[model samples]
Target: MKRIVEFMKRNYKIILVVTALSAILWSFIPREKKEDPEKDKLILELLTMVLERGHYSPVEINDDFSKKVYHKYLENIDPTKRFFIQSDINEFSKYETSLDEMILRKDISFFNLTNSRLLQRMKESRKIYENLLSKPFDYNVKESINIDYDNLPFAKNKSDLVERWRKQLKLSTLSSLTDKQKLEEEKKKENASYEEKSFEVIEKEVRESTLKSLDEYFNFLEKELTRDDWFAIFLNSIVERFDPHTFYFSPEDKEKFDVSMSGTFQGIGARLQKKEAGVEISELISGGPAWRGKELEAGDLILKVGQGKEEPIDIAGMRLDDVVKKIKGPKGTEVRLTVKKVDGTIKVISIIRDEVETEETFAKSSVVEKDGKKYGIIYLPKFYISFENKENRDAFKDVAAEIEKLKAQNIDGLIMDLRDNGGGSLETVVKMVGLFIPEGPVVQVKAPRRNPEILPDPDKRVQYDGPLVVMINNFSASASEIFAAAIQDYKRGIVVGSKHSYGKGTVQNVIDLNQFIRSSSFGDLGALKTTIQKFYRINGGSTQREGVKSDVVFPDRFSYLDMGERDEESALPWDKIEPAKYEPLQINYDNIILNSNKRIATNTTFKLIDENAKWIFERKDEKVISLNLNDFNNELAVADEKLKKFKAISDYKNTYEFKSLPDELALFEKDTVLKQKRERWHEEMQKDIYIEETLNIISDIKLLTKGKSLTQKLSLN
Candidate 1:
């Protein structure tokens, strides 16, 4: 078995593995560190063997690859262009095209030299920043700093490096000046007798804060990290060239990955590790914003975080907990993560924040009444399923129960709010879609080098055949796209939201690397996840890149961004085969849709929505920003003023009213937290323009059907 597995590992190229495996046998041999180069070489050889044989699409390691890896690894380490000067680049340039050769020979000379230089530069830069912050800056100077670094060249000498640090420090103080000015103004507004600190004192405090952040950053570097951590970043940089999703997880990274996956939906969904160089992403939660965005991945280093439209605050050497605090914010808000990719390019990605929900707060439904007609709304956060037991806490079952309760209320319409529900269990999605249509093929799965298999809804019973609207946005992905595409293909419901859902249609399998090596006793080999299958809609069209399109599209905040599966460079391309033989629903609401579009075109909410989308789009693409305080403040004020016109957007109201079902209401009375969550949900739903519009359409459907329930009307067929 061991010999056969070795042969397979040496040649096999399309192995599918899961994210975590418990098949790890006991081995006390401690994992290798870079201190012992021979043992580290063994781990590398094992990893290379696995990648060469198991990755879906592995590239040959040639001089071309070596050059790519060299540049990418270097860029990943020094993304800010501050630490390494032109001469440093020249010295390292020789190895830029020789890195792949070194990998084959298991040479560590390049890493040894670069790591040493980076440490030296870090120490040098620390002294420069401390010295500059030691003295007060003359704020009266009209000097400006260029905020964008994309077009700039590396500093040619030490003096230039010092200038770079000076501008960065000045930018920090400029922000502090604005904040202090605000604090003083607010104090005076609150009370006429209030006293405020002077501008000089505020400037001193701001400089002190910056120095404190620096002190803590240096403390972490000197204490908690090592050279091996930097080398791990280098290894991952090499692997990522295969695809955005492929990565290398150091032993420490694997542990962090397990812990973070346990509470993934709570933050930006990225597991970060502190390293001798900076902070690197250990792994991203499967369905979190980082995974969905495609720009972030394991091995990529987080350079800074910019809140809202503010310039990014450097967190390269900052403490891990403090870095996390800046990333985590209230749901529906935005936090920009400035990350350095394996290739060294720096980009700021904006993610709408969210958090993990408790079981009781995960999924809920409400009833909205319109024109004396009642409609039911079921908001599924994700297609959750418990793996421990067969019948415990399944999302499909909870949704079915909600449907039954809505039917008892004699509801006129039903809406499944799947906005920002990244995706979850495939089985639950298959079962959930079954509730709306008759038993039929739901999704098609295509494994590597195999014919596509049609996964059908095995249950023949239709749970709800009424007026339906399924909501989705850019964040709706994987299984969410599966459900939305099936419903759209069946023409069973009117799909609504952004242009389309996130187009992540490929299925991934992760496996324990140790399972492949037995006698070697080389300790833990971590785990590897590989893409194994492509998912297609029932109509035979792949949802890999071109996700399911909405019937009624709206100008959502993400509409203008490069956020879909198509935007992912490594995403599988869309394709088609013979269409599956399944019948769409026998209902027609083409005119109702046209009526809704007409109303949508003229709606004030959508008008401003379009304008705001434009604003966000323009803001993101701006190539230059002034670092001068007056110029910065003036520019920000203009944007803020424009945003004021849309203040009423969140407060828009209609005559629609929402209420919980009797069972939930009774249950909520006993659980105060549950009650509060439901009340908050109801309040938000009332303010949702999309929900308001949906209620109108559903009410129109009721009028068109002459007050007959949709299920009853469908019975005539």
Candidate 2:
């Protein structure tokens, strides 16, 4: 994502040497007829080789690293400590420190042992849950369950494990039972004649529902997941030890990664969810072929999928990912689906697969009027780009187009909202930052043993020059940090929202592992995403651990909670490099920040928000919950009462009205779905206190700029 070009350009020789070595070795290795352990060994060998040679800063794969990987893998498989007992741990603990040696020798004995034991334990637990849920729980008894699974030890024996499972299940049912009771009470309040079910009847229903969900979950694990899937998990536990960003993507996962980054794929564009009956249509992407066809609808169960003129394969009891693979194909291909419609009719629906764009993934702008001035707000969900095709839609081009449209409407100021944006293509972000500034360094990336390379906006044309505000939150990461850092460094705009953005400055490149082997009987070898570079701001400060600190910080629920890159144990260290040469703009932010802070300090809504944030921070460590029905109900009542004051947070709205651009308004006549999405966005913005504050800040900046201009003219005269 960050260093694709640089990696290929600089590491061609290293890649060639490894490819030759892997080809020679793979040629001699015996191919197994039964199991795929040979492929696993090859993956381990290649991953270590590439990571050691090509990673930004690879860690020593010694005993310490081995211990971390061992525990992490176990935690991944049995996180709740319910499946594996103390005896299993004792058996697996022998390889805790020797995993490094085992990995180097291409021996997967540890993985083999753990995987088999876990499967057996999972099979046994199924019976325990079924037996426990069969009888009515004594809700009158006082008991508590702690959800801090990491701190809990493995059960000593089978009896202890069953007791642990009982408490967990009881807690879950108790929660559901209370919710159902409240729902029935509300229904009775609405209509006195409404027939309310008895407590026993509701309790039985909750148990049945829980059992169904657990059965479906176990069914998926038993049917869908293969040895390769578990091996992928083990591989990730190894690779992530190098850094949090480094990952091993299985063949199926690699495809998903590509789809996520590009936000476009060739498919019927119906979201599917796995259910006991079959794969259900969760939703249809607007403007997609399936939605346009009108034959497919949400809640329809897909029975089978077929290619053009081919025999359909029944998708009953198939994995959701597998079902999706069968339905999706290259653009302009015909795929027929045998579906059971919501109306209880079974029919075959023919759909031509086409490129479907997830509208929510792209940037959209809304124009809002505040204090008689129109300002534009552009929300970018991610810096998306179609890596396979440049001609396809990208965030940079779309944002630029939106800027032009907003300018045509004669907007006074601009706000770029990057909250909850996890970031995407690095090139897209560089071009996006170029839209605001006139030719300057956007970010400085440094690879291992290499000088920092400045990525600058070569374009001298400035798309928007007036007062600008960039909004960010704790979830805003990588490319988002790069954009915010550049904007802050240039003094070109005000950064607002959370205390700081998500600290994820490292760049990754997905290396196709199949490229290393010339030929293989072992099918697709998948890919690896490894950290290759860490980027810094134009001001020489790295956003690795210390993310871009906002010029004006807002109170949030996670304000005091540890999160982001800093919270990750394997995150790359933050460092500073020599600053790139750039001129900072002369704008007076002192008065603006002071004024905003004064307003926030006294505003009742802000005060309440700050208080709510503290309240949330206090409850962050509350992991234990009462399983007794009366006690659980009391706990929920106390929480509800405490949260009643914070309800105003959602109800709060500004006096300004938000409107869509004229172009979108015209398009809305035909695209009702897009219109509805925009309406929801605009409605949310109307109630957003942060947006209101940003608009006020923009107004202040505009007023300050005008006053300075008049002062300079008078002085010259």
lDDT of each: 0.70, 0.81
Model 2's alpha-carbon lDDT is 0.81
**Model 2 C-alpha lDDT per residue in residues 1-717, reported as the tens digit of each score:** 121222223445456546766766667655544258878998898899889877889889999999999998887777678799999999999999999999999999999999999899989989999999999999989888987787889999999999999997897677668868888999999999999999999999989867875776676578878998888989988998998778888998887866645457889877776543458785565557887786897668887677886645545434556778789999999999978654333567999999897786678899988777888999987787776677999899999999999999888888999986777777888888888887778988787887888888978788887778999987788888989999888888899999998898887777888877667778888998888888889999999988999999887766777757887778888889899998777666888989999988988898888888788777757778888888888887787787788878868988778899888999998999788777877776788899988888989877766523211112211
| Tens-place lDDT digits, model 1, residues 12-101 | 224333111112222333444324455456556555666665565567888888887877676677666778899998999999778877
Q: Kindly give the stretch of ten consecutive residues in candidate 2 with the minimal lDDT sum.
A: 708-717
Q: How many clashes in candidate 2?
A: 0
For every candidate structure, what is the RMSD over all alpha carbons to the true structure, in angstroms? 7.5, 8.1
**Over the full model, what C-alpha lDDT does candidate 1 score relative to the true structure?**
0.70
Error of 2 at 216 (Å): 2.2
Collision pairs in model 2: none
